[model samples]
Target: MKRITTLAGTLAFALTVGFTPVTLIQAQNKGRTEISVKELPKISSNSILGSFNADFSGHNVSSDFLINHLGEWLGTGSDHTYKLLKQNKDELGIKHSVYDHYYKGVKVMDDMILLHEKNGKLTYVNGEIITDINLSPNQQPTSQRIRSIIISDLKPQGKLTISNIEEVITKVSNGRKAVLYHASKVEALSMKPLKAFTYYIDNASGTVVKKNSRMHDADTPSTSTTYYKGDQSITVDSYNGEFRLKDNARNIHTMNGTNLDVDTINGGIINVEEYISPVANYTAVDTKPAVEVHWGMKNAYDYYMTRHNRNSYDGNGAKIDNYYNFDFGGFTGGANAAALDTPLYGGIVCMLYGNGTLFGGLLTLMNPVVGIDVAGHEYSHLIIGRNGLGGLNYESESGAINESIADMLGTAIEFYSGSSPNWTIGEGIPTASFLNPSPSPYMRSMSDPNNVNPGPQPDTYNGTYWASTANPDADNDHGGVHTNSGVGNYWFYLLSQGGSGTNDIGNPFNVTGITIEKAEKIIYRALTNYMTPNTTYMDAYNFTKQAVTDLYGASGNEQQQNVKAWYAVGIGNGILATSEAVRNQDHFNIYPNPVKEGVLTIENDKNNVSVEMYDASGRLIKGAQKLNKGTNKIYINNVQKGIYLLKVTSEGSGISTKKIIVE
Candidate 1:
């Protein structure tokens, strides 16, 4: 499913280019390339821009050279130009520069140009450029007018304090209709450091076209005994004459939530009702559940800082803003649920907890804040939200990666804190189930991710389901991000515990188990250094494998185990890393090109060929093991008529995939 951020002022846009002059040139191997603003590729994958030797007469060039002559090179008028976004030298000694495309002094969303140079020679060029845009400025709303529109429409809760506001140009789409918009960029009101929203208001129509949440920070003092921590010294913050639950040592703050108003655009702590102060200082210790929450938040923070050397979720000394006792109606029921806004809520990263209870027939109730793994999991989500970590798109493969990584890291944090049964998330939550609640209710398990508290989780690639094709939307966990996340979760478990077992597709394999410490470091490096916003499962596998190689030798047991773990989870590309020689494309063959009755035959040089089939959507259909050498028949009689892939594997032949059709 395509997970869209739908807010009063959220934007989803694709560029629409117009006519412009350009010159096309042919490169040695690259196709004919055009140097036109409107003609440039929007994404980086297609940014080869022909060959370096063929273009520019094999001369080295700099970003400054392109900057000075870009207008003439693209034949754009004076109304548009490129502005340097940032420049940095990578770890490999390559200079990288990013530029934002501006039209008539307003920034265009996603119109970026990236230049990578090695030793003063241009090695890469990629960007989204648009030329000849007609900027007919209408008598649109001014900055104040746009701000007013946002304020009036949003009806934000609590006191409104606009942090920053600016102007920009963006393409806005109301449903299928798209238009150019002059917009006012407004930051959400800050209740704390990392709790606010960023908004883009269309000045032309006074409508919000785009927005994202700013969100994430904490202090400590010694206090009395607590229910959760059990008579231990707790941290508290004292200022002037008031005592609050903010922890100065760990930089954690606990806010009390009383009036859980939901109708407001920014679901904020209601201030008008004297609804719980910004910081809580309990009148009595027993009356405060925030105490337990404060303890859990501190544990999560320390987990990352001590284990990963991460200062905070953003790797900066930002305090954590945590709120408890959220009584928000409808969805506020704490039963088996907790929420950390994936996107910032007006720029705040706070965890909301519900006081779950036994209803007429409700099976389980939960206080999510008390669970260390749950706390760690929610906080990990904030860490992944940072600029790196592939941005782990909240849809499809990337989305599942996002969920699984969070689960794995959250599990890591729990283990770091000495929690038992480290593989289980929300293990601390008491069994609030109406029937047979003795075992205690848990959210999920890493060891057996296929079986979850709530259904729909697919533990292996073969069991995977896409939100785009299945049930899309937040209700369906954004295309089964949580469900398919089981694949990665199981991989982590296997990597942590070395064993051989039958995979979801019924393939038996053994994987070397690596310590969780090593696995975590590799995953962390991959997320921060090697990953991009649109990374896929294959990309993640490759990235993690490379990470393991970077830390350990390429041919070491660690690397092999990493590859095997990925393969065990149904990511077969790991075999390519194990041995490059076995991946020859012309080694095997399959016959009956398009099977008439869904029966396919494979002819191979070796016996014991393993086979697996998948539908057009990349979902696993069926599999077989130990096929004979010369000729083997695989029946897909029940397989529907459509395009499919048949992947054959052998111990000696590696893996070969062929596309098939059932007529």
Candidate 2:
């Protein structure tokens, strides 16, 4: 006996057997006996079972009972081999041998023998055999099916279950861990096909992790289908997976592509799809999560946008991605630091917390003012990152310029954000007073440092002073960015509040008492448009003048006022002095004040002037306009704001120069 191994081989044999052909049978009876010859019956080609006949008392039965009995008997084999062979022969309609046998005592005495007749028939037998015989119609071999029944039964299921479907999809898509919440269950009858179900997926784990809503929907029953919900939530999940309907609790659906029975906890059943996979730390937050950070960033963004009409850090609307951390040191207190580290100079996207001391403490205490201004300041750094002023803290005048620019912007940002001008640094910090008590005064003074401490020294001089002798890092307080910044600081204060003719350092002209608005505009324009990375106090002088001129035409008194304001603070008339020639070309001349005849003083510095008095018309009279050195006193009755031209020679070059003026 051969052992049959696979179902495929058996099925093939059965199909072959079912198609075998058969011939019609006829019976003949003679005298007391009868004989019948019948061919094997053919089975239907499409039938799972093949046809067979029953042989009893020399009679062939073609009834369904015979076919069924034969099938049952053959099916008992270890592999149904006989049944498959018979089915193949029957299906093919091929002639095949049928085992012919009779009962032991039943034999044929003549061609037909009458033993026991029932109804109107006589039974007879041609021969009888006791042993089983082999019969084959046709045999052809094909690809063998080697799979065993037990082996197939042990195979694990490949389809995903409702609980695990979302996890699998998220893992495949993002390669991260996600979580799903089964908030509600849905009844089988309430389930709809191809509709999305809302699920709360927590992408980050832990107590601080935030969750977002993702929509999962499918067109057909599938392993997974992706659905996008705005720019915030997007998800793909298995089609027949569990879901929660609005009125029902969470429920699962069966694999037959139909909804499954689910147990409800409350009112109605609602299916929720969740992200159950884990993701990396740096994935960009969707629009919704970004809103959390937006609350903080919006103030800074709007300040620049509305006040400056700047879309973002670069002036072109760009998205900023922020992070909170403390990777670098050097921050004081527990204050948080905001950094613009991304490729997008769009704004300060990265902010670090210094355990709530300097950065964080200041932010916390000054939430009223420092919040928006500091954010604005940090973001401005991002702008500077692109349109940089050389290198930050560059030591030379450039360093001072950098600090001044930051101060200007920082103050401007505050004003823009609706804060009053305090002219103090870190006013938010309670311990950080603008002026120190005794020994050493404040770090910087916009008003008068000399007033607080005698030798404090104003920032008007073109000299550098070190705040600390121990630390040569120069960056101590960022190269005294806080220290030397006083010069520009005082300059701004003086310019804003008409100059006192002298800066903190007693200089000559006093033009104090200017409006803050004009000062702000001038400083802002200079910092943003005119100043460079290498700009010095002199450069700043030039830039401020240019800013004033550009904003208020050359002939405008506003420009002249700005020049006078700076001049009053010891800053010389910068490059624009040449341009102002035609606009305010008043010949340099001076008149004696409270003159007592013998002591007439002529005070002016434009050119070597020789006073040649013209009597009414054009005649020359008396003393040379070029008086001797020092203080020259000329005898004059009284002169008004009238016209005068004095012939003077260059003191060193000997070039005679001329200027027309009225006094």
Candidate 3:
């Protein structure tokens, strides 16, 4: 991996020269501005919830206390109340309570708050908070009116299930707005119930203001033996002197199934007894597949917790449920697929896996349940959906982004598990012989997407078969989500491995390897905090650069490397060219050296460059440089009266010097 020095050295250089660099000050200011979003804040008993005040004691309480006291504590009378949306204990055993805010018996849309309690003391609080509102007579529409509107909208498909009508305050970017609405949720049961869809109807206008689907589809291929923690471990819950497949440590549940005989109404097998267990207590030998699934879940949980301090996929420790031996069409459906069901219960996502077809019905492939990468990939879908900052839309480029993220996290998790062939998805899983007589070993290869035996997807954005959603093709995997995702998949590989190669569009470039650790952090932060629902490849390019900027600063080499990485992936074309001018030793010049309007313009004929300004006493004063070619402008409004030296550098050009006067 390429190692680069951090900006601490620049700070030291500034101190030796007698001036604190403006770059450092700017970072401090930026930190202050983003603190509220990046860190959890303590919540007091008097913390306001809507117009009402939170009334629970701040410390030493049980889960029951939170459940029973929320309504009274928040000063919500019978008319206005709080309902528990979800609750779970984090890895640290801290209980997190998530609630939906309601006013005068109407459900608020997307208005949720969370309280994190450690050892019975409220340690932190987050989520949407509404402060401005008029508790006036905002009468909500009647349930009959809401049901009529919702039923009409959901006609011919979804069946309305439960409905909540409430009046509540919502936050706008500028301030807050109090509104009355009925939140109606619906689900349609065909062979099985599809994900529930929710709609918020404005009581006054009787128009649908917003809509949400509570379902999240989370997938896979593979047969090879891999080791995790010497031997695979499963978390079992004790019930009535019998043990069941449940991992309370990571809040995951496992179930066994026979030919997907799920009771759609109950959401699983007719009886929980179908859940598998070893004949003897606490044994991994009997339930090998279940043990593998449990181990993968633990590794994924560890990856999120140890790497990002996230408790689980939701960042709040929500439970994850999985069912194995889930053959959809009896034994025939085995080996063809594994799936994370879209249905969500109390904010939890469930996964279903099938055994391979009996008598080699699937050719060479085996059951996908045991592949660590497959488990990670399926779990990531739920994480991406539950992401609060913004979720990638489930169609087109957004959907491709969603798939690529899952693939990336899946691969990363596999690597974390000390698995071999980390660059290949389902590396240990056996492949099929559908396309050839020989059985391949991988479902997808990150380093070489085209190498997948059965079918190869485009690795470059403009590769010959690159799928685009512009012209719809329903038969094409929902606008080629699995296919086009190779673009991102390969990009991550290049970012991790540091190679010179042609991108999907046949653009040639070299990237400095940044190791998987740094690479995952950049990708995770961008996907979680910055990338919005409809984020495209171009948007990911921009957000990833911003993520690097946040972690390594604007002027550091990390940002430069980030630009190069994206360019290697066939994006950020101009960014690298601009930086190249300075490195190529092009004629670098700065005009109007004597500051009058506090602005300085720089021009480089051949390459993009960066600049640092130092005082006459050799103290670094400013360095937030992105020296693009042709009329690069910077403001030195606070330079003060002094003689200063400006240093310019780039990848091709070694270093150049210029002097400026602050008038």
Which stretches in model 1 have alpha-carbon errors above 4 Å?
A: 1-234, 238-244, 260-289, 335-346, 357-364, 388-390, 433-440, 462-472, 576-663
Worst 10 residues of 3 by lDDT: 10-19
Per-model C-alpha lDDT, please?
A: 0.56, 0.33, 0.55
Of 1 and 2, which scores higher on lDDT? 1
Could you tell me every candidate's TM-score relative to the true structure?
A: 0.58, 0.38, 0.58
Q: How many clashes (backbone N, Cα, C below 3 Å) per candidate?
A: 33, 96, 27
Residue runs of model 3 more than 4 Å from their true location after superposition: 1-230, 237-243, 259-286, 329-332, 336-348, 358-366, 428-430, 433-436, 471-474, 574-596, 599-663
**Distance from true location, Cα of 384 in model 2, Å:** 3.3
lDDT, candidate 1, 1-663, per-residue tens: 011223211211223222221221111112233233333222222111110101121123444444444554444555765666567774555565666667776776545555656456443453344443565554556656655765675465454555455667654333322345666667655332123455767666677665543321103345443334343345777665556777777788776554443224664444422113234344365434566666667777887888677887888877787666554333323443343443323444567654554332242455434555666776777787773422554544556777788888877876776634368766555554544445435667788765554544665685544234132333455466766777888888888887677776777779888888888888876676445443556666766765564455344578778888888878764553212111112334454445565677665567667888888788999956567867677887898887776667788657665566677
Cα RMSD for candidates in order: 13.9, 45.5, 15.6
Which window of ten consecutive residues has the lowest lDDT sum in model 2?
210-219
Error (Å) of candidate 1 at residue 638 is 54
Q: If ranked by lDDT, best first, what sequence of candidates would result?
A: 1, 3, 2
lDDT of 2 at 645: 36
Q: Candidate 2 — which residues are off by over 4 angstroms?
A: 1-300, 320-371, 388-393, 432-458, 462-478, 499-504, 512-514, 573-578, 583-663
| Model 2 per-residue lDDT tens digits across residues 1-663 | 111122222122221111111221111112221211222222211111111111121122322223223322222222111111111121112222222111121110001110111122211111111111121111211112111211232232221111111210010001111112111111011111111111112122211111111110001111211111112112222323432111111111111101211223332222322222232111333222222222224445665666556676666665543322221223333333344232111211333222223343443311122233344445565554434222232333444555555555555565654544455433332222223223222223456533323224345644334243122131354234445655676677666675554443455665544566677677766555434333456656756665564455443556656766666545774223321322111223232222223334444454554555443345543347566544566654554343333344445544322222323
lDDT of 3 by residue, 435-460 (tens): 34554577777888888766576776
